[model samples]
Target: MIMQKGKVKIAAVGLGNRTCKYLRYVEEHGESAELVAVVDPDPSKADWAREAFSLSSEHCFRSFDELAASGLQLDACIIGTPDLYHHELAVAAMRSGWHVLLEKPMGQTEEQCRDIVEVSAETGRIVTVCYILRYHPYFMKLNELSSDPRMGKILSIKHIERVGKDRTAHTFVRGPWNMKEMNTTVFFTKCCHDVDFVLWLTGGQVESVKSEKGTRIFTSADAPAGAADRCVRCAVEQGCPYSAVDLYLRRKDWIKGFVAQPGESQEDMILRMLDESRYGRCVYCCPENDVIDRQSVVMEMADGVKAEVVMECVTDEKDRYTVIECENAVITGDESSIEVTYKDSSVPQEKYDFQWTRGMEFHAGADHQVVKEFIDSIASGELQTRTPSSEALASHLICFRAEK
Candidate 1:
């Protein structure tokens, strides 16, 4: 289905960090995708979109229902809402004749994920999950090399995600994702991409999953002696790495967007949030912090490929490391480069670099490429050929089974 020659009209549901990426993509590719409508419960988010895209008030909605009832025609919608709300919004958009670019995990439960797959098939809509890693050049190249005859059949694969300690504290400890039952597990929330990569690179279905997880460090027992519940009141806050002052106050640029509310200066906002919000709480003592700081999952694939994925929120640098052992070659890589060694001593080792930029366009530029692919697919009247929702569901199912 080739689309007619024109801009692919798009609406954004939930104006969060991921939505911001979609906004950036549409802005960058103005000729390919048009930002027509925006929805979020927060008016500030809606206003941000309206100002960014020059959208009229009528097109700025507070919820998906409002946008659907408005009767405005659109080619597709990007659902960047929270984990739990993905199914409802995505299904609604698909039923209304709009293609969907859904964020990963699909939903919190396996049932919700299957419903999305069903709805997508019923509606014949293109649902591309945000598996950005699949679009990264490094992984793309790795996939290419995996199929090379020289590599032979893959026997085993291991993937590791080292999420920086500060990030773990910021996002999983003091942030919205702190509670597993309320949000999702560490594997589903942070390492779903890894599970998907294992399946993709091995070309094998997951036969069984066994996992072990625990909050080894970020617990009340690990709190510093005499430390206050809030960093603002802690006597040792100046020296603590996860101090609210250091994390939020020192980083004014980072604080401005999310923390600094209307009429509040950066300093004032930081001080207030530290005194009143969970972001300023001691990481080890945060009552809401329940997710694991580290986890390991071992999986048996249908083709007899043994795979292991380790997720640790204790590193200084955040990146993915993967190693694949094939019959004739050993492949190893991080986010930027890959190294392949052939079994034959005469064959020299080959190294390839992806040259990915560090921040914003992280995941080795997959962040941008995924959006580009989504927009291109919609404009071309074709389904997303790669990293579709069905493929994402397979990964999500593995995470669910592993967590159980």
Candidate 2:
């Protein structure tokens, strides 16, 4: 692939929210890259592209083969397809002479990841895995906070993911992410970011993990009598905030933007839509939802950096909960100040209730910062992708062990 005037000619394989984000990023920036080809089975999405952006008609292909065979001068391609197809698509694109910006989990298995890495080395092409949360602004702050020497040797990490009630019932519990077997295991698919973060924070490899998960509130059997496996239709939906009846067809502003904004290059709209949509399907319940609804991992990383990851679908609203107690560490947030309390270790059993707040304010949402950096790296190869095929496998190694 020849570099055209130092700009990479790119093709996007999947037309999902992620694909759209990269496309929009290029559209808005109008400098980092160019969209030379797009591949998606959805004609409507293809049509939207032509109308919203001046994408060439011939540049669109119904399949990857068509795109590769079209002889379009392309340097890189974004593999935004589902988790199962990532490896296959990525390998194909690499063999076709395209560098890859792969969406995360790298692949569903360690073997698959290794295969991709081997192929990349053999092909001499760049491959960046998309762990979007790593680029979010908030996460960068967390990274900075974790580096405080005054924070003392970090002992544990408290991570709580409040997968909204609506999302639990309508999508997660009922959709592609429903089962651990159909696609990638739940850990690799949903919590890969947390795993990566834990690895980054501890600066060590995860030695071992013990986890437990189950379907807490929603179940196919729990559906109204005679209810189908899917919750798109059920009599009890109106009363249950998380029921599929209520969340099934609900569309948030982000979803609207995802559908309406054809030339959109930012992930803000998709993130908002995911944030606004209350359907419980994407996270907790769907046909493909086989992963644990809630689970915790106790990680023993190298150097004895102990950490714990907790993921729960039981929250009224979508929010994050975090706390760090240490002196000399300046903690700040975009919204509110974080309160830190410390007591004298030398003190005998105290009879008094004490509270201390002197450190920096604590803000939330580091995932967004992780995502932004990913885009920047793609635009300007200044920041090499840390979560490449090789580095990515270390996180999923724990999940593979759990399957046994």
Model 2 lDDT per residue over 247-281, tens place: 33343322332343556544543443344433323
Top of the candidates by lDDT: 1
Error of 2 at 260 (Å): 9.8
Error of 1 at 148 (Å): 1.5
Report the Cα lDDT for residue 400, model 2.
65
Off by over 4 Å in 2: 1-4, 224-234, 248-289, 323-383
RMSD of each: 1.9, 7.4
Best by TM-score: 1
lDDT of 1 by residue, 1-404 (tens): 76658998999998898888777878988989899999999988877788889999999999899999999989899998878788889999999999998988788899889988898898999889988878867777888999898899999999999998778878888888888886789778899988898888887878889998865578888888989988878999888878877888786423534635789876787788878887878897888677888899999988899999999887987888889999999999876778999989799999987554455354556777888888888778777647788778888888888888
